[model samples]
Target: MAYTLGIDIGTYETKGVLVDTAGTVHAQASRGHQMLVPQPGWAEHRPEEDWWGDFVFVCRALLQDSGVDPAEIKAVACSAIGPCMLPVNASGAPLMNGVLYGVDGRAEAEVQELTNRIGEDTIISRCGNALTSQSVGPKILWLKRNCPELYAETSHILTSTSFLVQRLTGEVVIDHYTAANFSPLYDVKTQSWVDDLADDILPLDKLPRLLWSDEIAGHVTPTAAKAAGLAPGTPVTAGTIDAAAEALSVGVDQPGDMMMMYGSTIFIILRAQSQVSDPRIWYAPWLFEGEHASMAGLATSGTLTHWFRDHIARDLDPAQAFPTLANEAAASPPGANGLLMLPYFSGERTPIHDIHAKGMLFGLNLTHTRGDMYRALIEGIAHGTRHVTDTFAELGQSPKRLLAVGGGTKNALWLQATSDITGIDQIVCEKTVGASYGDAFLAALAIGAVRRQDISMWNPTDRTITANPTADYDTAHALFLRLYEQTKDIARDIG
Candidate 1:
């Protein structure tokens, strides 16, 4: 039986799985890594150590653990935390640590500079996005301004996934879903790189060739095959970013179908039948060429929860702290005992698009306990989700089905709070192994072993998290918006 290998390089860890045509995971492996915060508002991952190293390790381990013939695996696919900015030389050597997604606020000034130089309307019309912390073009400019020597020496600009694919097949390519974040540099209408707009950001030649997500990038070369303990010429799909893969994993393919990915950050991707020209949210062509994707994300979600555990619940074992905290949070009342949190630890993204936004713990009092604070954090991220869903409603793009995926799906409090606050029932699939599972599915699709529509059968919905009426959540959501509005200027001043 033909099997497929899927690996994902995430912010805090890398995970991979081997799956057969029946969607049964034959083997799985994981490796944990740290996200470097060199300074405030900066997040970095070494591509060599974290991205490629994890891939080789996971691939070899999966083959060893499964004891399956390497020749039986038909294809390989991968996803990663993106739209990262990794400048590389002609030899594909990384110039510096990869700059992370919206969380890394190093390019805030560059985002503004681009908007001023090229009109915002021009960018939105041509690129389907405005200059924000998430845009890769601005990050390239950041490198040019801050590290000119390195920038001048740079021969190519690639994301984490692009770097990995190059390592595997010795081919440089990026998917449209991921390339969309390279706003102003990527032409959405033409679905290709436009050197005219990109010239000021970086040399036109620095960008990778574009392809749809499921298209075969290239076969793994002999060198990569030996490195990864696989056969030469194994087919590999043009993988996407983690959120897109998670959406695909759960069968989010139709119009109005959405996936609320609760990973290190809270990401939402809504499949739109037509183009959504919204500056408040991002717009990208779907993984498939003909479809469209309307997306939004928070700067921090699970990351904030981790911060709370590390600082507030530091006494507990790191392995067990999350479960313990979840238990404590469950014991607390729904409104988090009058505590409200703004989950902008890194900075806010989506609707507000405020790069200077700071996290706040409001309504904290002598009566509050650590459990209450923990509950507050979960609710805070939920409130943030509500904000994005609200945008969809306001824009007449409300999701027909909301599929919840990623680690946060296991946290009942977080899932329930999100549903209760958003009033949208969420569908949880049987397999929440997340992006790696989607990668396997994409690999299967690439090889014609499975069709795109087969995801519903491959990973069926397990259960639905129905929205429960919550009086406090409604009030808390109002205050959540008010708090951000009131603190807008203050956050900018302090930041």
Candidate 2:
């Protein structure tokens, strides 16, 4: 049987999966990488050493583990942590480390300069996004102004996924979803490069061709094929960002369907009939034709849990410790005895769009214990998810169903709390291999092994968690709403 390979380059790790057309994940491999922090709020990844190195490593490992001849693999797809910035020369060598998504804040001055030059209205209208650290246009300009020598040699800009595609296929192509984040530089209406904006910085010709996520970008090159143990000339599709692929893995294909990704960051993908713009939410064209998606992003999620465990609860082992913590949290009643936390460790992204906001824990007193603090942290993330859900309602686009994916869905406590906090029933899919698995599915669809709508046939059993907001939660939620309102200004000011 013909097989497909899917690879995902995440912030902390690169993973690959080999699968048959039937959605069975035959083999999988992953390798961890570092997140460079040169200064406060700056995140970078050396493309060659970090991104591509790990990608090639995982590809070889996955192909070996599958025990299937690489020649039998019909196609390949890639999903990456992006809306990232990677400036490359003509031969596709990284000029410097790629600026990471939202976590990186080195482009602060660029954001301000773009907002001043283009005005906020024009940015929103053209890009369907705002001048936040997430946009790549300002970051490109930042390189030109801040590092002239490196910027001078830059020929083309590539997102993380596009970078991998270029190496594999010898063709530079970017998907609309990832390209849309280059606000004021990517014209959303035309769905093409905005040559007129960057007159002197970079040429329009350097930009990669744009394609939908599932469309064929190119075939695997002979060199890449030999290294990856794949058949030469196997078709490679224009893949998408990790979040978009995660959403697809959960069957988010139509309006009112939403996928909530619980990972290093919290990302929501809500399917829409047409393009909708909200300053609070980043918007992108859907992977397929005839659909749009609105993104609700929080800069931190599992990252917060990692911080607490690694730094605060250093003595405990996470495998054994998290369950103990969960039990302790369960012992405590809801609301964590009035302790609340605003999970803005990496700055708030969705709803508020405030990059200056800092993390806050409120209502703590002598009565609170370590368990109370732990419980409050989980509740804080639940409250953040509530904010995202509320924004959807506010925008007149209420999702009828919420599907949870990634490691976060594995935690029953979190899933229940999130459901209760948002007053939405959460559906947990059993086969959640996440972005790589989804990318494999997209490849299957591209090669005509499966029909697009027939994805439901492979759906995992739904373990539903319904969070019914109680009168007690009503009081707590009212306070939760006001907590951010009263503290947002202070968080920004202090930062």
Candidate 3:
């Protein structure tokens, strides 16, 4: 049977899947890696070790476990945590570690400088996005200004998926969906790169060639094939950011469909009928031509839970900690026993875009327990999700259907709380394999083996979490907003 290969590099782990065109998973594999924080406000990943190394390891494992011949794999596709900033030399070797997404706030100064110089109105009009930490343009400017020597050696500025595709096919290319994040560098109207907004950032020649997400970038090279254990001539598609693939995997096809990704961060992607020009959210050309998507994300979500488990719940076994904490949180009353948390451990994104925001645990008293704090943390994340949804509603683009996916969906309390707080029902698919599973589907689509609507057959709805509003949560959400506003000045001072 003809099969396809899909791999995804995430913040904490990499996952891969081997699947037939019929959507049967033959084999799956995963590997873990770290997000290095060399200093405050910076996040980096060793491209060779974390990105390409994980790809090679996962590919070999999938092949061995499935016993599938390399030549039988018709197409290969990949997705990664993106809108990342990485500088590579002419040979496609990474000049330095890959700078991560919105979580890394090192380019705050550059974002402001460019926004001021280019004018926010002009930026929003031309780019369809505001200069934030998530934008690759400011990050590139940061490299040029802060690391002049290294920037001088840079030949191409690529995102995580672009870097991976280049390594596989020896063709430096980026998808329009991911390239949209390079505000002031990417023109949304033309759907191409331009240097008119900020010529000082980098020459357009240094950027990768842009293509649609499903377009064939190139064939795998013999060298890459040997290392990745794939056929040398297998076709590779122009991959996109992980979240986009995840949305497709869960059948987010129509304009009103939104995918709520509960991964390292709470990333949301809404399929839009037209371009959304809100500074609060983000706009990108969809995977296909003439389509659009609006995105919003929290700075931290699942990562905050990990932090609490490691630091506060040390008494519990590492594997059992999350479950135990969940049980305890369930025992606590709604509103988390009057506790409220600000999930700005890294910083805030989307609506606020406050880099100096700080994580706060308010209403803490001696009466509080670890369970209450954990519950509060989850509720805080829910409040953030509600904030994003409200913004979409204000823009008259609220999601008609919310599809939830990722590791956090398994957490009953987290899932239920998000639904309750957001007042929106969430649908979970049968295959929550996330971006990698989406990658497999994209691979099939690229080779004309499957259609976009075929995703429903591949992974149907498992269940839905219906919204259940509560007075306690309603009051808490109000305080959640007020707490941030009242204390933001102090948070900035402390930061």
Candidate 4:
């Protein structure tokens, strides 16, 4: 039977899957890696270790575990956390670690400088995105200004997915969906890279060639085949960001469909009928031609839960901590016992785009327990989701169907709270394998083995979390907004 291989590099883990043309999983493997924070407002990943190394390890494991012949796998695809900023030298070796996504706020100054220089109205009109930490253009400018020596040595700039695809196929290429994040560098109208907005960032030749997500980039080289335990000459597709893959995996195909990813951060992607020209959110050309997507994200979500578990609930066994905390949170009343939390541990993204925003646990009293605090943390994330959804509604593009995916969906309390707070029902799919599974489907699609509509057959809806709105949550959400506004200045002052 013909099979496909899909791998995804995530913030804390990497997952891979081997699947047949019929979408049956033959084998799956995963590995974990760290997001290095060398200093405040910066996030980096050792591209050689965290990205390529994990890919090789997971590929070998999947092959061995499934006993699938390398040649039998028809196509290979990858999706990774992006739009990361990584500079590579002449031979494709990483010059430095990969700068992470919106969570890393080191380029805040560059973002502002470019905004002031180019004008925000012009940027939004041309790129369909604002200059935020998520944009790769400002990050590239940051490298040039802050690390002049390394910048001088840089021959090519690549995002996480581009780096992976190049390693596999020896072709430096990026998908339109991911390339759109390079605001002021990428022109949404033309769907191509342009230097008119910021000619000083880098030469156009240094950027990767652009392609659609499903287009064939190149074939695997003998060297890459040996390292990744795949067949030489195997086709590789132009991969995209992990969030886009996650959306496709859950059947978020129509214009009104939105994927609410509950991973390291809360990333939302809404399929749009047309380009959305708003700085508060993001706009990108969809995986295919002539399509559009609107995106918004929170800097911290599942990451905040990890912090609470490690710092507040350390008394519980690490293995049992999240489940124990969930039960405790369920016992606490809604509104988290009058406590509210601001989940800006790494800073805020989307809508506010405040990099200096601080995390606060308000309404804390001696009467509060770990359960209340944990519940508040989850509720805070829910409030943030509501903010994004409300923005979409205001734009007259609210999601007609919200599909929830990722590790956090297992947390019943978190799932219900998000629905209750957002007043939107969320559909959960049967297989929540996320981006990697979507990668397999994309691989199949690239090779003409499967149609786009077949995703429903691959993974159908298991259930839906119905919205049960309440006045208490509405009051708490109002306070949540007020708390951030009232204390944002203090957050910056403390920094």
TM-score of each: 0.98, 0.97, 0.99, 0.99
Candidate 4 lDDT, tens digit per residue, 1-495? 999999999999999999998989999999999999999999999999999999999999999999999999999999999999999999999999999998888888899999999999999999999899999999999999989999999999999999999999999999999999998899999999999999999999999999999999999999999999999999999999999999999999999999999988999999999999899999999999999999999999999999998988889999999999999998899998899999999889988999999899999899999899999999999999999999999999999999999999998999999999999999999999999999999999999999999999999999999988553488889999999999999999999
Summing lDDT over every window of 10 consecutive residues in candidate 2, give the lowest-scoring window.
195-204
- Using lDDT as the measure, name the better of candidate 1 and candidate 2: 1
Q: What are the per-model C-alpha RMSD values against the true structure?
A: 1.2, 1.5, 0.8, 0.8
Worst lDDT 10-window in candidate 4: 467-476
The pairs that clash in candidate 1 are: none
Q: Which regions of candidate 1 are displaced past 4 Å?
A: 470-472
Cα misplacement distance, residue 389 of candidate 1 (Å): 0.4
lDDT of 1 at 247: 92
- C-alpha RMSD in Å of predicted model 1 compared with the true structure: 1.2
Poorest stretch of ten by lDDT in candidate 3: 467-476
Write down the TM-score for model 3.
Answer: 0.99
Q: Rank the candidates by lDDT, best first.
A: 4, 3, 1, 2
Model 3, range 277-393, lDDT digits (tens) per residue? 989999999999999999999999999999998899889999899989999999998898899999999889989999889999999899999899999999999999999999999
Better of 2 and 3 by TM-score: 3
- The digit string of per-residue lDDT tens for model 2 on 307-395 reads 98888788887778788778878887788989888898988788887777788889988988878888888889988888888888998
